[model samples]
Target: MTNTDVGITDDEGSTMTLGEGRTPLIPSTHDENLYYKHEGLNPSGSFKDRGTALTVSKALEEGIEKLHVCSSGNAALSLAVYTRRAGLECVCHVPEQTSESKKQLMEALGATLVEYDGVYEDIFHELREKDLDGWNVTPGVSNTSLEAYERIAAEILAQVVPEQVIVPCGNGTNLAGIWRGFEKHGESPAMVGVQMKGAAPIKKALEEEKSHAVVEDPGESLAEGIIASESFNCAEATDAITASDGRLEVITETELEAGLRELVREGILPEPTSAAVKPVADRYDGVTVAVVTGSGLKNYTELRELC
Candidate 1:
């Protein structure tokens, strides 16, 4: 099925078109039953395209001429592309450490990129203070964006009934959205959320059984996409994991690098963040599907250096 079949249409009955969904589910060579959901194949080269498409369409329908977002990289790029497609102005506030490649792509897409001196949460708070008169397209911050991610779970179930769904967690919206999607089908597959070892808010919250995420300094990691001190949808994501009998896992930078190399050996190029889920798959015995969230091309310079 196509993205239009799963995406939201506005009150005026106009749906965004980007061919953002229905990514390939290829069986992993490492295991006969294990599969990889290649979300990197999206038009914008990341899973964020799904949510951005819907948000931009809704903005168009409402005549919202400008859209604002705070992102690490992929979300900003996705927003820039969709907003440009919808003839709306896009502004992005990104962390200072955001990759140059991502920043260039966002600017190339005609988005105004504002580099911030702090983390994503800090940028988010600053943007709130500014009270930008536009639709905020940040994934977890905006409820509409979550709807786009639910389609990933639905598409997975349509392809195969896996025992577990593994995903890289940042703001936790994607994990929560996948659970919501499975709920629609009355299926509760085990949801596995992966994060970098030093910067894992969701994992810490799950381990501590906290109602809310326990804020901590997310140390550095190559998997910058999944590094978040606070996840906007942490509570919902924790609830989804608990409901599905799911668990959170953390992988070190070395493990992430190894996972990336493994993917390359298997002829699947993926961003380092996307490979974070690989270490957990071996721990599961049944059919498992790991969601590879973005393309390595976005981090081509870094990945090339690592190789």
Candidate 2:
């Protein structure tokens, strides 16, 4: 199917038009049977582009003049880009500790940045109280967001059928989206969700074989993109993982750093969050695909400091 065929469009026949999907599935140099779905190559430099593209399109179709989202980074950037392109006002509520690079990029794209004093959950609560004039494009909270990520699974199945699929988990939207997409296509690959050790609510739930998720305190990690105290769509994610007989993996800071370095050395420069899937993929025996969710450019300042 064509790229446009995988996306939602407005009644006026308009979409984000930034070429969001159809990322390359490149075989890994470490293991030929292992492949990397390079979602970092998306127009806005992250997999969040897929969801934002569709979400913004719906906003335009509904005649919503403004859009808002509470994000750590990637989602905000993606939303800012698409909303700006579609001539809608975008407001991004971000944590005070959000990356400078991401905050700058959001503002550069003309999004009004609102720095929240607390974590993302706090922002979510605040947003819920305020009557925003437009749609809220929060990842799991927004219906259109996860549906857009289904295209990733469709694209992956079209390219190659892997024994397993691994991806970094924040609010678990991507994990749920991929699993649902595979189900739609009558394919069920073992889905693995990876998260940083300290803030791994979904991982803990998966290990206990629990159908529900427990909220925990998020900790510090280089993989800032996947750190979350509570996933907005944890129930859906748990259901998907359980249905697919899937599991969750937690990576340490050291492991994530090493993985990022290895990917960059292999000419695949992904954000630290995206690199978290590598160690898990390395342990899998059969053909495996690791979804690298964002570009290293998103963390250029921090990466440069590391180098």
Best by lDDT: 1
Candidate 2 error regions (>4 Å): 1-14, 207-212
lDDT of 2 at 181: 85
* Candidate 1 regions with alpha-carbon error over 4 angstroms: 1-14
Candidate 1: residue 99 Cα off by (Å)? 0.8
Give TM-scores for every candidate, taking all chains together and pairing residue i with residue i. Answer: 0.94, 0.93
Residue pairs with colliding backbones in model 1 are: none
Alpha carbon lDDT at 40, candidate 1: 97
lDDT of predicted model 2:
0.83
Please report, in order, the local distance difference test score of every candidate based on alpha carbons: 0.84, 0.83
